[model samples]
Target: MKSCLVVDDSKVIRKVARHILETLDFSVEEAEDGRQALDRCAAQMPDVVLLDWNMPVMGGMEFLRNLRQQDFDTQPKVVFCTTENDVAHIRAALDAGADEFVMKPFDRETLESKLQIVGVA
Candidate 1:
């Protein structure tokens, strides 16, 4: 099965994402913050990552930069799932190694579409 890491500070968001990803036949894992997400990646890198922007320990952009610096044969496709819908935020995320972007309050369709666009769905 394909694997995915959902990184969000909000428990509700993580739970919702988990449900959607599981239905899509993905082995889902959850991380409350970017630090935990990084640890999870180090232990076992997932095929994709659904990352939130404003995390407590570490933000999504910082985590993306750190993750990109790691030596991986194939880096996980990162999708920034956050409320930062501004063009600059999206562009910065894309330039920081994110494969796609999705806004907050996303439904199943939106999440699935972004994942598909990243070629991980």
Candidate 2:
């Protein structure tokens, strides 16, 4: 099964994403912040990362930069999942090496479509 890491500070958001990804046949893991997510990736890189923009320990942009610097067997696709809908934020994420973007309050279909676009679904 494809693996996915859901990085979000909110437990509710993580739970929701976990359920949706599980239904899509992804082996899901959760991280409360970018630091933990990076650690998780170091141990076992997932096929996709659903990352939030803001967090206490490292933000998504920083994580993306750090993640892109790593040498992995197959670099995981990163999709920014956040409420930041501004063009600057979106552009920043893409420039930071994110493969896709999904806004907050996303549903199954939205998540699936973004994942598909990143070739993770």
Candidate 3:
């Protein structure tokens, strides 16, 4: 099965996202923050990453920029999954290397659409 990594500070968000991805047939792993997400990347790369913004111990925007700077070819397709709705934030994320964006409180169709946008659905 395909795999996905969910990087979020909120346990509830991570759990819910994981459940959704699992139902969609994607094996799921989780990280509580951007730092942990990087650790997951080093250990085993996932096909996609759903990341949160404004997390403690390393935020998603910084992580996205760092990942883009790395030489690794396996950096997962990143989808910024956050409550940040500012246009500037969204623009920065896209510029920083996020493959897509999904806001918080998303329904199943929204999640599926994001995956589809990245050709993972």
Local distance difference test, each candidate: 0.94, 0.94, 0.90
Candidate 1 lDDT tens digits, 30-113: 999999999999999999999999999899999999999999767899999999999999999999999999988999899999
lDDT of 2 by residue, 1-121 (tens): 9999999999999999999999999999999999999999999999999999999989888889999998877789999999999999999999889999999999999999999998878
Task: Report residue 19 deviation for candidate 2 (angstroms).
Answer: 0.6
* Model 1 alpha-carbon drift over 4 Å, by segment: none
State every prediction's TM-score relative to the real structure. Answer: 0.97, 0.98, 0.96
Model 3 clash pairs are none
lDDT of 2: 0.94
lDDT of candidate 1 at residue 48, scale 0 to 100 = 98
Clashes of 3: 0
